[model samples]
Target: MNPPVFKPRLSTSYLIVDDHALVREGIVRVVTNTWPHAHLSHAASLHEANKLLAEPGASFDTVVLDLNLGDSDGIQTLKTLRAAAPMARVAVVSANNDLDLALACLHEGACAFIPKMGSIDHFVRGLQTLASGGTYFPRDLLAQAQQREGAPTGVQPVAAISLTPRQHEVLHLLLQGLTNTLIAQELGISAETVKLHVSAILRSYGVANRVQLLLVCAGQDDSTAPQTH
Candidate 1:
């Protein structure tokens, strides 16, 4: 039998926040192809993006944002946007593919980090993952992150850390980069319950947040980590 097709929960609405018109145009083409009926809004600066995000009843399934906006630069742009649209998945597309910056973006709740240097297909696959409530992070970058942190490359066994069975399930999804909301939907649990399990998992690993937990569980299978395509 064929595998079941994944369906997105939200209607396809996107906010593309980038300072470059050319980049925005390219992304628009990719998104249009992915979701033919997708509603797209463009912002050339952080200020313009915030205005659109703050509009009453504004809801976007995803925000494809550039870290180096004209009004804001670096991770602060992500922080500000996260506050403005807490419900939207924010994907960072940047010229810099630095592993540390990518991890920082994840720590700040970005659903994906796509380096501008990557191919169009990579970006398209990322959009598809986000649409299905999954996150996309480049695998090579993640390996580099583990290397820099003095951890072995690829997923390591977590048998050393004792956790409840449910916490183990939560940890698996967490390593996959699923947000609490998505994890709740996958596990058929409340978001609050997912949050509690995540907190407990953090304590069990003696880590503070999702990013740290990921580092602690660096032995996890790479397939379980965020996808690149």
Candidate 2:
């Protein structure tokens, strides 16, 4: 039998705050897929987000925030938003995958901590968990953090990097040595979009090309060398 489809909660609303247009667009696309009818809003900075949230009858079920906003400190921004909208859940989407920062956000009332390079599965799972009034941290990250503090180990843990659902799909195909054109056809996205995702994935993995990226993902550490196009 096929897996059940994910139905976003009825009338669920979201606020996405990020400085980069492409990153914002990626998040928007992911959220739109899961919550096709959700009331989605965007802001580029803390000031802009505050202004929108201040409007009368302006409310959101969740706010997806970027930790490194241009004009605000990360935790301070979380505190400010929490003060202004005490009932809304906050999810921090950031490039900083530091475990301490993730823990700090949780302490300050964030419902989820999603790294920008995390796979689409983790992102969607985080959203689903938060929408149901629960907390979320990437399982691998959480496990590593726990291990550092003397928790017993389970399976060997892999480091986490963020990737949107579509990007994850592209990366999986790319690992199989597929070209952008082939990946585009496989995923039903434009080749241009596949290129964008590949570049973003490269940046996230700190590699210069597909070969190095595949190497890094295979538990190797060759990314420290100079990149080649």
Number of backbone collisions per candidate, in order? Answer: 4, 7
> Which pairs of residues have clashing backbones in candidate 1?
155-219, 155-220, 156-219, 156-220
Cα lDDT tens digits for candidate 1, 174-221 = 754568997898789999999998888776666566775655443343
Question: What do the candidate models score in CA lDDT, each in turn?
Answer: 0.73, 0.67
Off by over 4 Å in 1: 1-11, 148-192, 199-209, 212-229
For model 2, what is the error of residue 167's alpha carbon versus the real structure, in angstroms, after optimal superposition? 39
User: Roughly what TM-score does model 1 have, to 2 decimal places?
Assistant: 0.69
| Residue 122 local lDDT, model 1 | 71
Model 2: per-residue lDDT, tens digit, 100-214?
Answer: 7876776566656788776877677666554443445676675655544333333222234655656656665565445688678877899999999899877777666664453
TM-scores, all candidates, are 0.69, 0.57
Candidate 2 — worst ten consecutive residues by lDDT sum?
A: 220-229
Q: After superposition, how far is residue 125 of candidate 1 from its true place, in Å?
A: 2.8
